[model samples]
Target: MSADTDMEALMDMTRDQLHAAATRYYKKRGPTEPDVALIEYGAARAVFKDYGRAPGWFNRLIAPVLLWREASALAALDDLAGVPRLYRRVDARGLLIEHCPATAWPQARAGDIAYQRLDALVTAMHERGVAHGDLRGGGNILVDDQDRPYLVDFVSRIRRGRPWNLPWNWIFGQLAAADRSALAKLRVRHARHLATADDYERHRPSTGFARFARSVGQRIRRGVRFFGARS
Candidate 1:
């Protein structure tokens, strides 16, 4: 075999072993566990140039610093003015927002107000061609001292395309009870449907159904875990 081919094969093997090790480590540590390696692992190997300490091994391996840069660029566009501000790093976990204040989960009249704010935020997100992929409840929505609602956690948002709608019904289930019921109905109606980026482009400029379907799908996917067997 050519030297180039041998080098490529060796690199692939190394990546495979590294991924397996990382996966095992992540599984053992759990989703919330923060690993210092995620930040320094790639840098030590010269795979990364000037990424910050927040670039964990998992983030570097999966999302990569360049992808984050691209997302930053797209998010900076004026069209994304409605998208929430990404302030800075928090606890070596993710970005923090100064405007999105934290509030405890609401109840009764407060709950109703919170949902209204949430609906508006979701609508705004759709209008701007973005979908918060993990907008379940509690963590994603923060209430300020004035009871105003703000959005947090932008890691899993779908900024560029439409996807199958059923999964969002599952996500809606994780939010409020009323939303769960609403999403379940939509999921039942469009259970057989599938969508992609093309569908968004084709359906968005003309009909609103495509956008609605995409939102429903994303919510279902995000909330599905709550309705299934406990993890």
Candidate 2:
């Protein structure tokens, strides 16, 4: 199907239509707050994510907003090559997104070409005013068979308006810098041989906020693992 036609059809689909069209569903492990599944419908596949059943009062309150934020980010970044196409929102709880059959960065042998592509993708995202707040996670960065990078999971994206926007632009700048630093660290870990001295110079030590964010993410991941174990 043509990209435009497929996107149009997806936008028009209802939650019932998505459910009916789904021929197969495989629940996947995800971080805390979201229930994720891979759904196959005819020749197409999509990732279905619902954050309604998250544990704890805090998580329950923030889940919906996070889902919406991700959707908004996807819309703003639709022109990017590696970012997934947003299909449709399923009710207030769920989202159906275009599925890319790619493995996480940690599982793939990310070569120089892959890192270059990833850097370009990140640059593209920043130019469009969206900062993927969690690019440091290996799972959020995927590698295809051709060694191409695909960025996923935008629940923490930060979008800024015009340059004249004061505080927001400043905030966006910091986050964009963080994104670059994260990429530099990733290169240092995965493709150190190809990294330049400037790349090493750009690397900054994680701030308290970054450390706190990582801690919270790790706790959520552990919560998901615990839930899976009990189930």
Give each model a TM-score: 0.39, 0.77
Question: Best candidate per lDDT, number?
Answer: 2
Q: With candidate 1 superimposed using the best TM-score fit, by how many Å does residue 140's alpha carbon deviate from the native? A: 1.3
- For every candidate in turn, the CA RMSD to the true structure comes to 16.1, 4.8
Task: Name the best candidate (by TM-score).
Answer: 2
User: Which tens-of-lDDT digit does each residue in 188-217 have in candidate 1?
Assistant: 322214333443333322345433443543
The Cα local distance difference test for each model comes to: 0.37, 0.73
Report how far off residue 213 is in candidate 1 (Å).
Answer: 11
- Could you tell me the TM-score of candidate 2? 0.77
Cα misplacement distance, residue 228 of candidate 2 (Å): 17
For candidate 1, what is the TM-score? 0.39
Which stretches of candidate 2 lie above 4 Å from their native place? 1-32, 55-60, 204-231
